[model samples]
Target chain A: DAGITQSPRHKVTETGTPVTLRCHQTENHRYMYWYRQDPGHGLRLIHYSYGVKDTDKGEVSDGYSVSRSKTEDFLLTLESATSSQTSVYFCATYRDPANTGELFFGEGSRLTVL
Target chain B: GESVGLHLPTLSVQEGDNSIINCAYSNSASDYFIWYKQESGKGPQFIIDIRSNMDKRQGQRVTVLLNKTVKHLSLQIAATQPGDSAVYFCAEIPSSGNTGKLIFGQGTTLQVKP
Candidate 1:
């Protein structure tokens, strides 16, 4: 079973357009994290959620925003797409609130800003 | 500027031969570390993990070794195969303590020659 799933597996958008990627989980994990993967940068965290309605910034959260309305869903939004934001986005979840070491990740969402 | 880093960007090994990928971390207080493998067009998958208290851990045909003195980590794959060709990354918890965050390293690509 897929514990976590990301929507819009592949998306191509233009600059200045708004885009939203959805992450849904069936495991009911209390913590959710959004990350972007680039060629040489490996994976950089964008934002993370500790609980419903609670979110925090990460290493590269300057151009991204995230919202967790429910325990099983976390949404990432790009106000305006930029060429620098073209990347493969991944969503991860963990069951323990204190243990963020072991994370279960989703397949990923590839976003291309053209 | 303290982050996890890898020794090489790519490594080519013949099939049925042994392969080793190395990493170094700046955080001396980081007690928990994890290794992840990512194939092309896919999100990273967790391979194994090690703690500072322990020097080594084994999983199937893979082994992870932690050298706290040198702040180094290595992953060894026995009898490498084509399926093992992927990018490997090392991640560690912040030295400030476990605040539910992980710092990922620049990935090292392992190519298994047929």
Candidate 2:
């Protein structure tokens, strides 16, 4: 039931440290995205990639960066983790032109910065 | 100013009842809309979707109603169950073909009580 898998399902790290979350997909989708969910706020897009090595910033990409070196893998990195950055992260993939961009999401990665 | 938003923050319904969730989008250029369900500690799952050309779409136990006239979208669930309790979100994709980006609504937390 898991076409996509997020590594380190749950992680806790100290503030100011660097953290990276990985999203891997078995489906060979063309578009991949990373989003973070927090209370009272909608899922904010962090970054997305249209193809290999093609990445773009989203609405809330100030402190985060992303890379899609391959078609099956997308990585999100926090340069300096902050407590305010703690939230549940999700990875999603979509087949655009065909399904009209119906996004299929992975389970999730819960990160806690202290 | 094409933002997707929900009308309510929370909705509580009795078991075996029908539940309705409403959303409003600001961009008429958006051609695709989708609904997602998220549990407490998990990622969001695709529920249903509707295209701009169509007004209604139905799935097994869920239906999506799109009103392009008013830029409103709604999700209807038949016989709401406890298992259906989760946060629901509505997302819209602009017709600009930026398949990598989706504007997500705030969210509505559904509570089904027996």
Candidate 3:
């Protein structure tokens, strides 16, 4: 199963509200990534972590932040949710960086901001 | 923005037929490319990957073709099935770094009709 799960499969929220999406993996992968998929933008990376407590911003990291305090848990937080931020968020993990074998992904979390 | 595909190109194919989805990348230094499939309300799942050193790679029912000369990549699905209806994305990894930062292209939506 690769063992990756995202909490709150579907959520409807209000604008300016704070939301957090959690990604947990039983594999204890070293790399974790957060991405948002929109209608035409494909999937844009928000943030990623290479190791515990080490993270970096992705191309579309303006309104989003991420924290990875453990090997199996990565959290994506929205300081203030907006309508434009409504999209399907996905979390992925990898065992190795050099190996392009595969990135195990979660089922995805769908968020709609009203 | 190094490379962006705002308008995702689409391909419609009949069931039992073959399907091909193409992508063009910007970074010539990218050494690894991957193909992912994302069904409705789900995260992108790994399909296949090809390295810049190799031109083609095959999976059980899928093949990935990489043209380093034109910086183009294509994914071919043999015997398109109804379950293959999904959005497909192509991602590239920089050659120099081992960072888990992957540059993704706008995904192509494949519609398989019976």
Candidate 4:
């Protein structure tokens, strides 16, 4: 297993509240990714970071923002939580930049918006 | 838009039988593919991966086959066991101009019945 860990394994928040999930990696991987998994939708990329300060939006980046201040920490923030945002979020890391290697994923964070 | 998809949403096989899961990707430029397994309440785990240059790769009790012409990928599990029951997903990385991002397909639930 990779040295990836996600904080707040389970969270329940009310609508309009701000929620932030943290992903920490000890492997010093170069690329880190945030994804959400829902029934019937598989896993959808939310955001990803290539370096300490480099980040990019994914296919489903709306309502979600990410920041990578250091090489080991990547944060995902939902400015305003919504019911539709309730899903299991996963953080993954890859050592290669060409995306040819296997991605190691953390356990997951289950967030519920009431 | 290019996407990856599975042929079936669910598959059931008796224990000790071989199991096969299929995936179809729309992007012809995709050269790297991976298969992941996710148990209940857990994040996806890397199972096997194959590069476009190869037609097949084998691991312990697992085989990954790639067909570049049809953009098809398959995973074969030998002697399926109860532990093999999980949701399987196929992910791909485009060959050209890829920024180390992975696109996932809808998952296939595998049930190994005893």
Candidate 5:
């Protein structure tokens, strides 16, 4: 868990609704990432932030947008939720600079769009 | 589209026996690989990681092996216990523009029979 917390652990909303998931970390990490998990797809990177206000898109970033106004918090927002966007979202922070892939993930937020 | 995949969707093993989970990646350029364990109602946790420079890496009771020529990776757990029962995923950091964007395999569910 590494002091990482995600708000709205579970949410059920209708399609076309707006949904926002929040990830907060207690430590000052240089890297933070958002990933989504589906049935057939293990986990796909949605977005990531290297530094405060510096963010980049990932493998499945088409329907999502992210913001990192502060180093401890990264937010993912779906302007208009779709059924396809219903999945479990995870937020991770880098463990070591040398091994960038090593991450400490949060509990995850489950969103269901009907 | 180069993707990571698992040979078996599920693996059943007896307690105290060793278990091996295999993964394959279509992208040979991927250099960094990692394994994650996810239990029910929890986020994925980092297990181990290996760089392309080395073929094998070991942790407390887990080992990760990478075969670059065949674009394959495997995780071996010794003395499998009930706590070790979870879904394991293999992820790779593609040697591309953004290495932080890790691509994950579908995952293998390890069921330890008591």
Candidate 6:
């Protein structure tokens, strides 16, 4: 297991409310990513960071924002959550994105928007 | 539009039997592929990975095969056990050297019947 931890492992919130999930890693890796897992849709990337203050959008970045102010922490924010945004969120880190190394994943955060 | 997909959504196998999960990708430029297993209420765990330069790679009781000719990837588990029952996903990274963005395929749920 990797030294990754996700905060608020489970949460249920109302629609249109703001939600934020936090990912913390002690591995000192250079790459971090946010992904959402949904039934039949597999896992979709939301955002990723290569270093502190460096972030990029992914295939499913709509309606979601991420910030990486420090190398150890990455935050995913959903402004005005919707029912369609409910899914299990996973955080992962890698030493080198271009290398063949496997991404180490955290436990995951389960969010529900009703 | 390049995408990764699975041939079957569910696979059932008896304990001690062999199990195979198949994936296909449309991106011919994808050079790296990985197999991950996710149990209920947890994030995906890395199983094995193979690069386009190789035809097959094995790890423990798992094996990953990559066929660039057919744009197909497969994971084989020998002597499947109850602990091997999980949703397996195949992910690919393009060869264009992007920021490690991985495209994941629709998962195949492996059920091991004891």
Q: Which ten residues in a row have the lowest lDDT in candidate 4 chain B?
A: B93-102
Model 6 scores what on Cα lDDT? 0.91
The runs of at least 3 residues in candidate 2 whose Cα sits more than 4 Å from the true structure, single-residue gaps closed, are: B98-100
lDDT of 4 by residue, B45-112 (tens): 88988887899999999999999888899999999999999999999987755555789999999999
TM-scores of the models, in the order given: 0.95, 0.95, 0.93, 0.96, 0.95, 0.96
Of 2 and 6, the candidate ahead on TM-score is 6
lDDT (tens digit, per residue) of candidate 6 on A8-100: 999999999999999999989899999999888999999999999999999899999999999999999999999999999999998763457
TM-score chain B for all models: 0.95, 0.97, 0.92, 0.95, 0.95, 0.96
lDDT of each: 0.89, 0.90, 0.86, 0.92, 0.90, 0.91
- Residue A14, model 6: lDDT of 97
**Candidate 3 structure quality by residue, lDDT tens digits, B26-63:** 78887688888888777788898887889999999999
Provide all candidates' interface root-mean-square deviations. 1.7, 1.5, 1.5, 1.4, 1.7, 1.3
- In model 5, the runs with Cα more than 4 Å from the true position are B97-99
Q: Write the per-residue lDDT of candidate 5 for residues B62-107, one digit (tens) a residue.
A: 9999998998899999999999999999988888744466788999
> How would you class the docking of model 6?
medium
Residue B76 lDDT in candidate 2: 98
Error of 4 at A102 (Å): 0.7
TM-score of chain A of each: 0.95, 0.95, 0.96, 0.96, 0.95, 0.96
DockQ value for model 4: 0.70
lDDT of 5 at B45: 87
**DockQ for every prediction shown:** 0.59, 0.70, 0.67, 0.70, 0.71, 0.73
Runs off by more than 4 Å, candidate 4? A97-99, B97-99
